[model samples]
Target chain A: MQSGDSLPELAPGDLPRQFTSRAALQQHLQQLFPSASGALSPIVGGWAAAQERLAAVDPGAYGRSRNHLAGAVTHLSPYIRHGVLGLAAVRDAVLGRITRRPEGEKLVNELGWRDYWQRLWGQLGDGIWDDQEPLKTGHPASSYASELPADIAGGSTGLACMDAFAAELRATGWLHNHARMWLAAYVVHWRRVRWQAGARWFLQHLLDGDPASNNLSWQWVASSFSHKPYLFNRANLERFGAGHHCQGCPAARRCPFDASYEALEQRLFAVTPTPRRR
Target chain B: MTAAPMTATPMNSPILWIHGAALGPANPALVAWPGRPAVFVFDDALIAGSALSLKRLGFLYECLLELPVTIRRGDVASEVLAFAARHQADGVVTTAAVDPRFRQLGQAIAARVPLTVLPVEPFVAPEAGGPQPGDLGRFSRYWRRAEPLVWQRFKG
Candidate 1:
């Protein structure tokens, strides 16, 4: 397993820059940073990898189907998060491909979201950790648990979709944006855990764990940064998820998410309907 | 005679300090000095505080490996300063970092050696000779100002 050359020994207090394989690299990192738990992600990170993903962007399809589980989404967040691929470069690539403005508008607008998060981070500094706005949900902040429960963390939530999302996060260090929103909503709204606890849990595992994006999005789901907590019913999940999690799942008999948004909102929020606009 | 714009010439053996924010070849500092001695320090505080998984760390290491930077982990300021002294460099050159922690480290390194913060290419640069983009309170407001600017670069 010659990666490039034989893996080099660590210099005095300096980390080794060479490895024979991804496994070797993972093992070396396991030894080097013991506090960092979990295995290597299937997603390789480098300029070449980022460019390869960039080359495959289908702007027309991406704009149309990006919200679905099996959508034509660009798996570029991890690389983009770390600045392995710059935002402008990605934008230019998208713009270069489209014949019509509408084709690339959605993808470019998504890039704008990334830029927006960074700008907020610059403005807020560490204040991104705090709630940007008070929760519109009737429940008080003290009602949420301060830590992520072990069942959720261990992927034993008895709900197939959430457990699978947790497994994917722990194993791969990445999740589709929909999965993140769904899993985060479950943690905060259904489980009554603090968004900060869930945010910290995500930061521990997400490859794209930029505090600006992760925390703010968590705050969005928690109704601290948005007008209302983002919610999804079983039909919404089953529709977009392509019936992946519900066919033979243990939770199928009595799924927690098995209700309409209206019903779920009434049950979870206990307040009047949350305002839809900012 | 017409006034000429100044070019950013390389300094006296300034060490190219690469941070997580600017690891790619497109980094302004890297663009200024392509192959000069460069170092990337994995800040200890950031790792332990976030409890960063090996997955992310490995990703970063692989990215740095693709570049010509020495990989080091410790107190970021100390390691960067040590790397600068090791090269007998007159200064440190880095692209600006958004994170406050890195800005503090840049200050420490600058206190010891001349440090230059180069401008990165923004996703949407401010209007030429106009007031800065305003009202970042929401994405819609910001995009109303930025979306037009972003598409102005498109030739298609």
Candidate 2:
């Protein structure tokens, strides 16, 4: 379906009979956007290439390079998120390529995690969106008078990593899965912005912005998901983001915490002692 | 921001109610405790409350004279804790959905105070027919395909 077009009305029977494989789907997609051949061709071609890569590559490579922020990581999240690539199809492809190998076991576990998150979403239902800010009760984050919207969407954040990520999201409507975690953490913990704000920004921009993944991921970084909060330190920034690109990072001098990263992290993590249950 | 008026004496223990749905039989958990400072933890979908399910919830809330509660939207565990802390809530109540992450969070919160998990079945309006076998199959297929990448976890 073309972007911005209304979903075509379909009766239950009108839906496609059998699920189409990602490769077959990509071939059909190419026909829809033939004019932009060179620019789009590789994305279609990349699906095939990724399938091949999954066959021969080790799962360790995924863990290692997933955080590079540049394009080295597998860009499969968006495809999977949008249902452009089916999870079972991808799993089957990966499994077919590495059956009985140690890598296959590792990859299958990773797949299982996705299911786990989804199950969590189903289990929790709407409780997942409840507000959990400390000190401030019921004060929604100010969407107005905030640079967050422009910074995230317009790529004007000035932090090299943040800016690059924002730009990449806008340009390609995709971010590597690891980068998404980093960005969400930065926005919620380091930047001291509200998780809802970041969530809204992602929903507006990400092509694969599933409600479960985007909302849950933001909650995880905000320390809202777990009792202990997670903070991304300068050491982490330097390690994963070796490229040193953004010159305008608000946290440049202070690195991770001068930007209030630790406090933000602690805010989400520190759990007040609950009274003993009867 | 203006401070909320202190009408009644603060309860010795306050319950933080985290709701995942926008509407239905379970919504009373959110709207019932009026005047007691409770936090309403919800997600974009429920806040959007555009779905048929949630619309019913809004109507329910409107009909009830809710206790003093704070409405906040977020993912499950974090939102519940944040709401509890922000509101100085002594406990939490939520529906039983199978989010291990939220369950873990609930367990941790329970250690601190009371975390009550309410098992709620989706209340489809009577007029709405249940999903046919085919519809269930389509949804199942969609989930199976989306499961791997969407649900993959890191083994550290």
Candidate 3:
């Protein structure tokens, strides 16, 4: 992985003309990264290494291992998020190397989701804010803000998975795609924290923090953007994070759902229904 | 030269407000004002173009039409002074700006009119409740059973 310090700052003259296409952008990148070593040595080095690893590996393994908290999945989000690697370029490179299959299509769909969110942002400038429901009127026992600092930054939340996520997000500025969904669901449905607070916390810490994806994804889990809400159980946590060694999760016994490892494995690995906009 | 006596003013002129975000969520309180001034929202194309989003520039032009009370987009203070001189406006009311230039504009406008910068809280999403074991199993089953139908709809 490339460290933030290793990347060189480009002058105005170095930038490409506006409205450059993906192919043209790639050509520009090639010129920019001319030799094996350049000012962008870190980016080039990271991209080359990632591409090599991606080419040789079986992405099917990703479907099974993507949820594990350990180093079980590829970390391509940062590279893609920063515009260091264009989506089209990555797609072309991946397609060239791997046979197009259901698993590959799923990965591609994930990338397409990123594109969808950006386009949606362009379509709705502030409507995203407009659709927001006001915090329940009349004083509730607690406000979302009260729990935000501890659950997000302090990582003092009693939920084992939630605390682990907070710690990891603070440490690395990244989280697995699935883990993000799980975290958002747990926070909104289980912890009852407001989505906006969670979104802001994510943005403050995430290196790949994007307004469209982060905001909309939070909305989706909160059931604000969709008709139905998403909820997770303790078993779901155990299956995905067995190796992480979490401590004192609140959901262990108090949870409404079963926490059995085998039950969770069957549920998570099953050919499940894809998420949809309600 | 002898100055003509100024006549007492009639009712306060309504102030038209323009913004890029949705008025309801961004500024709910504004909706309650009795003035109920006309609102002109710029299209996305106008807001997204150039250094300043088209929406912002459109807002500037819209404010110009309501000169005197016209709330200028940049350097609120100067814009207010300029509008006051040109249109003889009663006063300017405007929302706060994040950009330094706009913030300055607010200060400038405040010099002339009764500018109010309303404070607001941002919206947030709620957390998920931990589901029961049977509910978890049901949700999983529901997800699996619905996959084919959802995919078909997606493809369509």
Candidate 4:
């Protein structure tokens, strides 16, 4: 059958037939559907594997360092996103493991963020694509570029952190939450691109990409869904990013993000007073 | 002391609709009705229209390998209904989804066949005896009301 054919014929035998080896299946898929020949890794996809991943989440470490580049972040998002692992099951696993309420709270709270986004998506419907609230940033909402610039898409942006992030997103299909925030901010705030443009780009690459979570988060960074646009400075990146990208960056001295948060706030939000509820 | 008389209803066997939102054995819908035949559709129109990448599709392909599911491609609702008819299923059972597109698909399917949606298991629970809140704009406010109830069902 053709790759895009509407109906695939089922084998006449048993259900849940044993799948061929990962490499073999991948090879078969590659030849049958040549377009899917990216650096896609077939992450072991089942309940047993998800449970194993859930068991390894260290809530305490995650709570303390989740914002850092090398934080103890749980990598179970792909599993959770696709329903291989239910959200409640993961919450139970974390709560069951960590004795301290405070430690577990952060991880649970993060999960709650996912729930919140899904709830919003349900309530808003297609409206999630539109700004929930008016743009609070200095620039008018209409002024934002609808298409992502070639530089950003190609990872040729002169900025060191952003280029690294772009490359990481393409190669690994994942990024830390903090990295995501920073990249989204730069795309919307600095590059003058719309959140939708960035959101679409992200959806194409992320393994755990969900429209509710991904689109809503982009809107959050754009200040269209939140009170203020999120912006970060060089110092924040250097501290949390582990400085690997900075070490090899050619723009180390004349960094675009050399200013403080206040300076950035002034530059990006010039003339516009601290965003008040419309 | 008394039991209602059993009536012959049109709905009997349930066919699991393994949607993109819930794609594996842990799916609550699957858990509710085990050993039932399952169906998955690779909607070309949806994939072609959206920014979904080949890698994401590849990931989904991998996930389907773990389940005893019949995979197909076409309009989601039509394909699902077709599968149900072929399997002699009286109704379709699928995991609840918050995505609007999925809801639309469910409604479309329901128009043609009986559709039952199971709740997404293992997340924050609704407030006890309290009305389900509508304000989802911020996380902090939502969590304050939801925190106490998230683990309400936990046995640990």
Candidate 5:
């Protein structure tokens, strides 16, 4: 990596094309984009690294275990999102490797989500920032706070799981799909923050922060684009997260997510009952 | 394995304007014109207004470093136009971007020079003589239309 720096390039005002180390790159970027803060993520960005990741993807395993925090999920979004790896190229790679439809179907379906979001963006333009439908969470949109609470933003929220997700997001610029769902639900439902606030916070740090995916997904959890507000219970979290967050969680005794779905629905939302058939 | 630098064949050939949406070697504009002098700009407003963090900027910078593009930062349209003038480009060629800001910049650049926007290869091309991304009100509805089409091109 340092080799490119030794060349003494000729283009005027062109920032150094190489760095002696990741630290050096970090230092240079700190000076260059002074407004932007935080340490560089361990995730390297380039086709070389991208190809290596692509090679390791196991579509079958991905389909089977993607919801687990330590699942065989492909870390392809940063690469795919930036166009370093085209969606078609990835699909071809998966198709070329799979012998049966089931092996690749979930992976392909996940790819479709990206395509769906982009297509939606083309149709909606900037309107992607707005909710696609009315909220189904049984609370008025006005009920949600307009900003993210400082505790959540600062990653000091007492719940070990949410704090860890917040910390990982800021430090790595990435999060697992389940963790993202959990965190979004916590923000919108648990904390009563507006989905837009969380969406903007995500875009500020996420490497693959395309507004379509980020905003729409946030809306999905907030029940503005889905049939119901997505929620997770402590049992579900412990089951999938393998007790990592709950092993010695400080809030373990009084975990807000500890309740049953029936209880949570009653406690968290204002359910408007449907009329009975006459 | 065989191609010539397009600069020799014509005067005012389009220079590629690489933006955030398409930062890789496989970008349609880069593929369409091999060896074309290319430029990438860090949009100042996005950096300042969005308050993008170092991770995002660093990642983008690293990606740009891997590609054979001249890198700069400032008003995207202005930087792209200046790069075009520097190369004596007749037009600007770029991959289409979903971001409206990109479209606005493309329009700005096109006001001074011809601009060409190439489409990205679709994840699932619409069925022949079928609805154009119709009924996107829900993913299930869209998937009902797209899932089978996507499987059609699967080689294995």
Candidate 6:
């Protein structure tokens, strides 16, 4: 935060040492910046690995099932976020594979979302940290807690799907886009935690986390950037998230999200749609 | 009108500034000035005081190994200035960032030295005639304007 003349004194031996392997580096970093609970394994690094990953993205399959838990999601987000693979390079790779433009439209559109978030940050500056618009939902902004609950952070929320997502995020440093949406919704809407709290927690863990994309997306889920608060139900979860997290979930019968979307919407918001002010 | 892109040319002295978001070979700034001594600093004031995890730091360390970047630690702007002065570099160049903090540091660096900010390679290019970003609030609106030329490959 300091400039040349007003620089603060850095601790002795603050420079990063030459790391021979990922494990060595993780171990060294642990000595300095310890993680909250579980730590993430090192993802594949370098441009060669990133390019190889890029080549493996099947746009057709991605468009078909990206929302499902078991989907053909291009795990290229971490690389793209870190600048290992440039955006143009990924687009070219995707476009070269599909025969028609529409074949890659969904994937391309998703990429555009990343750009849109970046553009907003460039325009908004620190405004991205605050609520962009008034909450369209009935919930008041002041009513939400500014910090995440210990139960949610510890991945023991008694909600199987949410806990699994938290565990996966802690272990992998990545999550599917749909999974991210669900997690944010659960945190901000269901848990009533501030978007900033969830945003910071995600930034702390996610390898692909960018303040613009991550925070703004969280805001969107919280109804601070979007027209309505995003919500999901048991049926929706079962349709898209039934595989791993739901397989042997002990909390299956006791699931809090057992109702339908409409029921939950009525219960949570309890009002007519707030008309857009064109 | 937008100024002409300041393409990095073969120069006697130029330094590349690689931060959290700009840390790889594909980095446009590093690509623009290849073979220059790039420096990645772990801003102590920032890292020690924030919720930065060991995983991110480790990931950054792994990425830096693949490039010829010299890793340093301390105040970001100050370290970059010292690194430039120590190497007696005439100018600095880096990838443009949307992060306000990064942009603040970039502006500070530009005020002191010749800093060239290069655009990141876009995933999708804007169409010749389209609505500006300010006009759009939702992703669907932005996509409508940008999708036409975003993936359209130019024919020779």
Runs of candidate 1 with Cα error greater than 4 angstroms are A1-11, A275-278, B1-10, B128-134
Ranking by lDDT: 5, 1, 4, 6, 2, 3
Looking at candidate 4 chain B, the ten consecutive residues that score lowest on lDDT are B1-10
Better structure of 1 and 3 per lDDT: 1
The CAPRI class of candidate 1 is acceptable
Give the winner by DockQ: 5
Candidate 1 residue-wise lDDT, A102-162, digit = tens: 9999999999999888888888888999989988778999999998999998999889999
lDDT (0 to 1) per candidate: 0.83, 0.46, 0.44, 0.75, 0.83, 0.74
Which run of 10 residues does model 5 chain A get worst, by summed lDDT?
Answer: A1-10
- TM-score, prediction 4: 0.89
* Residue A256 miss distance in model 2 (angstroms): 4.5
Off by over 4 Å in 4: A1-20, A31-37, A272-278, B1-10, B129-131, B151-156
lDDT, model 1, position A151: 96
- The 10 consecutive residues of candidate 3 chain B with the worst lDDT sum are B122-131
DockQ value of candidate 6: 0.39
Query: Model 2: per-residue lDDT, tens digit, B26-80?
Result: 2334434534444444344433432212222222222111223344434545656
* Deviation (Å) of B63 in candidate 5: 0.7
TM-score of chain A of each: 0.94, 0.64, 0.66, 0.88, 0.94, 0.88
Write model 1 residue lDDT over B1-156, tens digit each, in one string.
000122245477888788887767687877788667788898889899888888889888888777767789999899999988888887888877677776677777777777877877788876763224365777788888788899998888
Tens digit per residue, CA lDDT, model 5, A1-278:
62222232447766677678889999999998887979899898877879999999999999999989999999999999898899989999999889999999999999989888887887888888887888877888899999999999898878999999999999999999888888998999888889999999999989989898899999888888877788888888888788899878889999999988877877788883221110
lDDT-better candidate, 2 vs 4: 4
- Tell me each candidate's RMSD, in Å, in order: 4.2, 19.3, 18.2, 5.5, 4.7, 5.6
Query: Model 1: clashing residue pairs?
Result: none
TM-score of every model versus the real structure: 0.93, 0.46, 0.47, 0.89, 0.93, 0.89
* Second chain alone, TM-score for each candidate: 0.88, 0.40, 0.36, 0.82, 0.88, 0.84
- Candidate 6 Cα deviation (angstroms), residue B3: 11
